[model samples]
Target: QCQGGYDEGAGGLLVSFYHLVKLAALSDRCTAGVMPPGEAPEEVRIKVFLERDGDLTIPTLYGLFRGADWQERETFDMYGIQFAGHPHPKRLLMPEDWKGFPMRKDYVQPDFYEMQDAY
Candidate 1:
């Protein structure tokens, strides 16, 4: 199983989790003729919506799926979705001290970078 995809959902008010299982099928098909019986793995999707004006927090999948580490961080970075129990819960795309989630519906982009140095 792996974190196949993640993105801001519900018009930037939600965070979705798309999990993919048994990615080995691609390799198996390359070497084998056909998958026998019901050995094929099924993909699962789970969506969790949080209050737009409340704490946006959810349990981290990093413990079960190592592939979720970066994805979760990206969600936190871009959507301000907090991942509880994340080993390294830091920004993946934004600076450590950056303010506001740029992808959030209520976010207002600043006219200038606060941390930018004068030329």
Candidate 2:
């Protein structure tokens, strides 16, 4: 469970994962949202895991932060990040049934590799 979920939506780092927090049913992780007194909504970012856990599943904050709906969807589409209670856990930028998460650090595109070799 998060230590706090009251500051708009999420907060700081643990193990150096500023916003990539992953939670287990039996694990404890915290998440929150903050900004300067007058920051724009676009400045808000939802932190997930520290990139430590092997499993990347987490609960969605769409209920508390409506803005998260689209951002979560996009993250899911590109990074394979799963939000457990998301209202619509659909792909925003990729076709439905797309293979693999492209934004994850480990992802490797065949075309990219070929292009790199050509260069």
Stretches of candidate 1 exceeding 4 Å from the true structure = 1-12, 23-40, 116-119
Best by lDDT: 1
- Candidate 2: what lDDT? 0.51
Name the candidate that leads on TM-score. 1
For model 2, residues 25-80, the per-residue Cα lDDT tens digits are: 11322224433454333222344443423555677777765767777777667666
- lDDT per model vs. reference: 0.72, 0.51
Off by over 4 Å in 2: 1-46, 50-53, 111-119
TM-scores for all predictions: 0.72, 0.50
Candidate 2 accuracy as TM-score: 0.50
lDDT of 1: 0.72
